[model samples]
Target: MMFRRTAFTVGLLALASSMYSHAEKVEWSQGSGQSDGIVVSDGANNNARTAYLSISSAISVPAIKKTQEEVSTLKRELAEVQRNAEEMKRQLSTQQNQAASGLKDSSANLSKEIDDLKRENQSLKSALDDVKRQQSQTASSGSSNSSNVSREMDGLKRSVEELSRENDKLSSSNDRLSQRLNDMDRSLSSLESKVK
Candidate 1:
């Protein structure tokens, strides 16, 4: 649109210049027609048209310059916006990576906790088996010094019972930890969805 307007203005200026030149040529051709003949009126009209065309063309120059400046400013602003958006995307990517790292750390910690619990469970099972073996041996052997051994066996039985209780508690704790870890995973997935 601006191009077409500028072209039209230029065309008018060209036509005005042509008319002014033709008028000058006619004035030169007829010596008396130069100042005091019908050619004089024609020259006046051409000169006036040229003047108006120049003024209008002058007006269009500033408008064109302003339009170009505005375009350049808009281009600069668009570049700035693009730069800001890219920076924001970079920051977001960094934050997401940090969140993922935190999740991985939490998962690793949970896995370590699970492994520790499993080891504790195995230890308790082994202790229980040893206690059972001792009881079997004591029961099968009819020795004279059995009373003291039986009392000691009672202490071992109580220790085994306590270990069983602790194992049960650890199992329940592990289940809750597993559930919490799953919940954390779900929450992270939800957070990722919202970010996208």
Candidate 2:
């Protein structure tokens, strides 16, 4: 009985293998020395190679499109950044020009102020020289005036001394006149007595 069972199992396995082999069909054509073939299989059996190729392409198509969109967005952003940089450069140039103009005006004002200061300094020097010259002239004139005052003082002192001597002479003359009057009165009185 065991031998019969083993033979039955072997027959079944052989039949299933034959059916599996028949289900796969391979047809080939020869072109010169090269060969091309078509491989067909049962529908129930999935082909890993074909499935992988189809799935990978489906995934890759969308991924490539997404990559292109991302690149375009990046490019636009880069262009905007470049434009902003250009605008900033222009603004900076304008500011620099304004600063230069302001500096030039300030320099001109400072130079004019310096010229004015130089003129004022020269005028002050001229006035100082005139003052010095006037002071010297005044000093010389003061010396002459001092000499005149000294001479006037000396003359006045001499006049005062002469007046003092004249006063003494007048006093002596007055005393002599009084004495003569008194002697005349006495003589007259004696004559009167004799006559009597």
Candidate 3:
């Protein structure tokens, strides 16, 4: 009889230990309360009800505190993300403004360059026209047949041809520069669109 009582006591101890281990987990009670409560029970006769109430009280407050702490941490993370996004937007706006200002400055400079080239081209044309008029007047005065005058006339013709070639070269250069300006204008427009 004593051995049987000892075995029974050991089995009860094992069952009680297993119950406590399982009940160590906190469960949230579905109710409108400040702290979510827990309910624990030992699978036994009379003492089970008493054990459940005691464990429930012990576990409820800590579980609710943990949930609140997690919520606070999530709120902080969300605020940080919003701040970072605002900073990125400000930086992008600054960069776009700088790019637009630079493009405008470049366009102004190109206009000035084109105006200068046009003035130089007109000056060259005026000089060439004056030289041709002087040659025509010399040709009309056919009084002397000296070798020196022939050589001088030949030299003047050569000068005229040289000037003509130089003018052609300048005109070609101006055309190329105009084409380059057009290309730059297109590039600026494309960049502006991408920034927008």
In candidate 2, what are the lDDT values of residues 5-113, reduced to their tens digit?
5566556545545655644543222333333322234444554111111112223567779999999999999999999999998887676566555545554554555
Q: Which ten residues in a row have the lowest lDDT in candidate 2?
A: 48-57
Model 2 residue runs over 4 Å out of place are 1-53, 56-59, 143-196
TM-score of 1: 0.63
- Please provide the root mean square deviation of candidate 3 (C-alpha atoms, Å): 11.5
Using alpha carbons, what is the TM-score of model 2?
0.47
- lDDT for each residue of candidate 3 in 69-158, tens digit (9 for 90 to 100): 999999999999999999999998888778777877887787788788788878888888988887787778784876766787788788
TM-score of each: 0.63, 0.47, 0.63
Q: What clash pairs does model 1 have?
A: none
Ranking by lDDT: 1, 3, 2
lDDT minimum window of 10 residues, candidate 1 = 32-41
Q: Please, what are the lDDT tens digits per residue for candidate 1 over residues 1-196? A: 6677668766865665575665533321222423211222255345422133222333456778999999999999999999999999999888987787787789779878988988888888888889888877877787688788889779888987988898899889889888878877887786577567
